[model samples]
Target: NKGIGGFMMIKNFKASEKIGDIVARFPKAAEVFKIYNIDFCCGGDRPLSQAIEEQKLNQKEILERLEEQYGTLRSMELEDVDFRKLSMTELIDHILNTHHVFVKTELPRISDLITKILRVHSVEHGQTLSQVHKLFGSLRMEMEQHLIKEEEILFPKIKEYEQNPSDQLLAEIISVMEETENEHDGAGDLIKSLRTVTNDFNAPSNSCASFVLTYKRLEEFESDLFQHIHLENNILFPRIKA
Candidate 1:
């Protein structure tokens, strides 16, 4: 069995285990899940077997792939600080500093780039670019508010509960987390829509440099957003609830 700081790795990759729990424990498992077209974010609560069966995927192949990848990459990835072992406050701080900052920095830049490409390439790619613009606008709005709620309300309350635990505080935290999670789902749907409209962020062959750059940036944004949501929904919230 793989062990790090006394946290035993899942040796068998049991089908009964929750997908989110597996990703939370083994972050690198996400790469394999993505290749299998698994939804590890919004649809993460389901069991491995259920997801595989629903998607008509072969369970044994996925399990074997996860175990093989985990074994090969465990030393390189798990040698770093384990996120599960971090204190609640520390985890919150990391999210705020890392993910929050990235969102704030990229949203406006991507918005401008998208607008430029839309204006320049509207004649040919008008419909798709328009859809991308509209979806990104909704995503930007949702994420802006979501960040405010986390930084202003939910995060502070969590810290307070850590400093002085109480049933009332816990209830408040749970309420806010649920609301935040719903917002997460909304943002996630918008992202999926964006991906669909942009053809998974694949730029056309004759597209300008700016057009290609916009698609690249959007893909980067999606990747970062997935990691951000995975941390909160899979790791942080479960820790709080436990």
Candidate 2:
């Protein structure tokens, strides 16, 4: 009976479930998934089993970890609001006010920090810093444009659809959502490239304050961006599609 109960506990997180759906349900699972190098954002459309198999991770171990984390965290008062319960307008507002504002504020700050680090440490870390600068620049452009598209075009359409609820409006919303998702993939790839270039934002031992801060901010940027993407990709888009 004890063995069967333990097995059932681990089996709570079904292998066939979508990675994004899992994160959507248990928000804290994102951190656990990150520790295991699981993609719960742009690449989150696929099943957990596929991701585990491709990453060559132990299935039982991953499941056990997920189940344990979720069980513990589920009882606690987490900072993350239950996005699944928010209305479409509320969710859209949350995305715009939270994630969109974050990008607008952080992009320039991180950009300047990257430039300063590049100028100061270029001679020593020129190759890596140069790559970081370019990747960050590309990501900045994509995010800026993406925010505009969502705020001006897609979001308004969604709001209008929510008010009126027409099939034509839904179709338009779906089209824009698809394009937005593709752009997300582009930004996600650039973020991954930045991480690779910076060796997962690990600064050197001989680094100055600004150098260290740049790496730290970049990692923070990645974390926030992942959460932002997760909200849109997992929660918002799925709700609209359904």
TM-score for each model: 0.67, 0.68
What lDDT would candidate 1 get against the real structure?
0.81
lDDT of 2 by residue, 1-242 (tens): 11121211223467888999777545556887899999999979999999999999998888888777644432222355687988888788667644564466578888999999999989999999999999999999999899889888999999898889999999999999999999999989999898888888999898998998888778877876887888899998998999
Report the poorest 10 consecutive residues by lDDT, candidate 2: 1-10
Q: lDDT scores for all predictions?
A: 0.81, 0.80
Which window of ten consecutive residues has the lowest lDDT sum in model 1? 1-10
Tell me the spans in candidate 1 whose CA falls farther than 4 Å from its real position.
1-79
Clashing pairs in 1: none
